[model samples]
Target chain A: MDKQHYVLQAKGVDISVNSAQGRLPLVHDLHLDLKPGKVLGLVGESGSGKTITCMALLQLLNPKTIQIGGSIQLNGRELNGLKPKEMRNVLGKEIGYIMQNPMNAFTPVYTIGSQFVETIRAHTPLTKKQAIELAVSSMAAMDLQEPEKLMRMYPFQLSGGMLQRVMIAISMCLRPSVLIADEPTTALDVTSQMQVLSELDRLRKECGTSILLISHDLGVISALADDVAVMQKGRIVEKAEAFQLFDQPQHPYTKKLLQARPMLPMEYEREKLVI
Target chain B: MNLLEVVGVTHTYGSFRSFRRKEKAATALSDISLSIGEGMCLGLLGTSGAGKSTLGKVILGVEKPTKGTVLFQGQDLYTMGAAARKHFRRDLQVVFQDSFSSVNPRMTAEKIISEPLENYERLSPSELKRNVAQLLEVVGLHADDMTKYPMQFSGGQLQRINIARAIALKPKMIVLDEPVSSLDMVTQTHILTLLNELKAEYGLSYLFITHDIRAAYSVSDALAVMDKGRVVEMVQDKDEIFSSQQPVVKKLVSSILPEHPRNRTLLNGDVFV
Candidate 1:
């Protein structure tokens, strides 16, 4: 592999959470590298600090609550010591993040059309008309049958799956080099989950956008990732190529996680008696 | 006689600001009837508003049906007076989705488990402690956990504590409303195994309510598929589940992404619902 292909690198990253809840390190000594135009899936249970690593990458972590010490480099640009202005300018243009809940990221007062326009115009000098056109076109590529219909609709009107599609569209409209999606389909139904994830896969394959996919669900990670990282107690327990990790898990934590999958469901009987 | 019976049961949340005026009383549960025998497990599968929950609430006498009856061991559950109904509740219980939320945050695990024994029957403080410890052990939780709060336990561990509390009174049956849906897959398996073991030991019945058809398959001796306010299908044979030729059952069966190796989507779009 060429050195030029490695897009992002992290070394000994640590994140601490401090609130009324008290102070604790959420991510400890985490390290990973992402190649350009490749999908890196991070799998972990709740409170495993996958989201903290993503936040730390863009310097978007809470300053009041979190203390961070580490190094993060994207395309040879050191992210750790960047000034506020430089970090702000680098974030959206270089790294587009799709949060767990897309509704939280969007405003309720405006139509998705207006929101998409604002997102595009904020990053680029494109006018509202041009942004809307680009947004609709990008949304179309995600197999959103009527991007026009979605463009005019409020976030509340669209289903969880459809909103995810729109978010993907907005994320891609700027042509950001790296995209981070955190549990994008956990809120969706099975069919909708497959749909949005497939679309995300298609986007990465076609557009060459390096993806950092973070989810607790191994099934979702297995479907999309070229590389896999398993986290436990704020640490990466295992990291390998997706096939290698799934096929031959080196860590005991990974084995425990695999056994935890719903291979045997006996509750169907309970449903009948209880209801 | 069945342990629980429903005859043409209909539940209506009698109208709203505009809803009542626009439509006749919305029948949340329509002409629903099912019999669950002693120690029999019945699965009710449906979406969020599929009247599955309404059936559970009615069975527990939390909600009264607009039509028909819910019979507990051939006695009408709704017709009883308040005091009698309160007394009747000793034989019934509910385990909701969230274990931590189901448990009072302030109460220790010991307090949580002991309340049922005291409420249902008179017990000395020492006897209550003994019973609580036994209940905790039965549910596979250690006696040492009695001193801990619900927040200290993981989701799976919290669920074990909830189960301990539910079984404290040794109710004839429990209405489990998506108990394991909020839990991880591994935790779900452990809980399922525990429930099965307890049912056999206590000769208990379970009314298991969930939307996931695959999850339902494991614990069900018999199952009912509910759609919109009605049970569209019920599995009679214990051996064959998902082997049904019925179109609606097939759709429900296929929608579940099981470990079985097969392309489930025989026909798309309409089958997903």
Candidate 2:
């Protein structure tokens, strides 16, 4: 396929940090392709450079202490070395990000309404009244209850699950083309996880928003990812279609990762039968 | 004999005097009742804000309930005398979700594990060292790790240290609050397996509290599904939960994504736009 086929593509990407000891290479030779409206899953153990890879794409990495190399093309536009002022226009307006901890994502002192409205106004030329309307409607779209009441509450007043949904509402309000969710559901409960995953699924289907989903849970990846990339020690050990990676893993690290998941008894029995 | 019994426990947060005019006191746990027999595991499954942790605190005697009784071996936990309360404290231990915050940063693995032992028992410096090393070995950590600090260990390894500390007093029952929830796929399995082995080897009863159904089912013999500060359903047999028709039970169970994409029944949409 041509380079224009994918909405977001990374080639020969390298990420490293400068420390007192020396330069340390954190991620190496990373390549990823996200076709329009498709979900690409990044699965790896903790400290495997998954978050760094996503941050580098958004130009969120600190240039003073960290150096990111290679080409990151978003909608045929180079994004790796974009200036901070230019990058600000691209982030949130072009690509949405859902962080792992929703608590830390928002300012604790600010009400959700002020923050949400401020975000909407920052991205678009909407007036404050229009931004508030957009925020309420977007929150309602995510099935949040009492949007008006939630608007007045501070980040500390909301539960983790509620806060996460609010974060998603804010991210998706502007209808970004690509969403980068880094362990979005890791802090949520099971029921809330289901809601968040379904919302992500809906965005891709209804709005044609591509997603880069990063998680350590294989179950979460299996539910949504069309393609899966297994990372180990800052390298892409294996990349395949979701079913192929889960069913017939080729790489030893991928195999070990798949086997390490705690399976329910019914799933275990099904595996026994398949074998 | 029942190792622990939570009889008609009802706990409410915020006193009536503290509440503003429009706001009412929130009921954390309402008329919750259950019991864990000797050497049995009871998994409390619920969503966030579902009062699972409140119930854990009530059982551990950290919080006095509004209108219920928590009996530890037939003795009222809150109303126990000082001597009995000391016994209760030594017998019941807890491991919280965030291992790093739960432990003191400056304390070495040895000092952290031996904290409980030092409080309850009298041991010389050399004997205490040996005991801490033995405890570390039982939890599958190296004896050399005793000198390491909390930051030097991974999340899973730190959780193991927490577990070693909990079992240091040879407590009869341990309240594990989301012990494996913060770990990755591989490390979660390792910790759950370690918990199961320790339970079998020590004949310990666990009030395992978690929102993850898979982790709960792997360790518990019985399961209780809680929703909105109430036990919506309780299953005596863990496998029987699969056939439960309760809405809360079904919601928690179905939230677990299938092992593979082919088996996924929850999500229904085309792969691409």
The model with the greatest DockQ is 2
DockQ, each predicted model: 0.20, 0.76
Error of 2 at B52 (Å): 0.7
Which interface RMSD values do the candidates have, in the order shown?
A: 5.6, 1.1
Q: Model 2 Cα displacement at B257 (Å)?
A: 1.4
DockQ of candidate 2 compared with the true complex? 0.76
Residues B1-273 of candidate 2 have per-residue lDDT tens digits of: 688988899989986664456546899999999999999999999998899999999998989999989999999999999999999999999999999999999999999999999999999999999999999999999999999999999999999999999999999999999999999988998999999999999999999999999999989999999999999999999999989999889988889877898777656775533
Which number leads on lDDT? 2
Assess candidate 1 and give its TM-score to the true structure: 0.83
Candidate 1 per-residue lDDT over residues B1-273, each given as its tens digit: 899998889888865557446755777899999989989888887655678889999898989888899988888998977887776697788888878778899999999888877777788888888888888889888888889998898998898888887888778888888877766555677888898899899988899998766466667778887777988877765445567676656655555542211122222222113
* Reference contact recovery of candidate 2: 0.81
Best by TM-score: 2
Off by over 4 Å in 2: B18-23
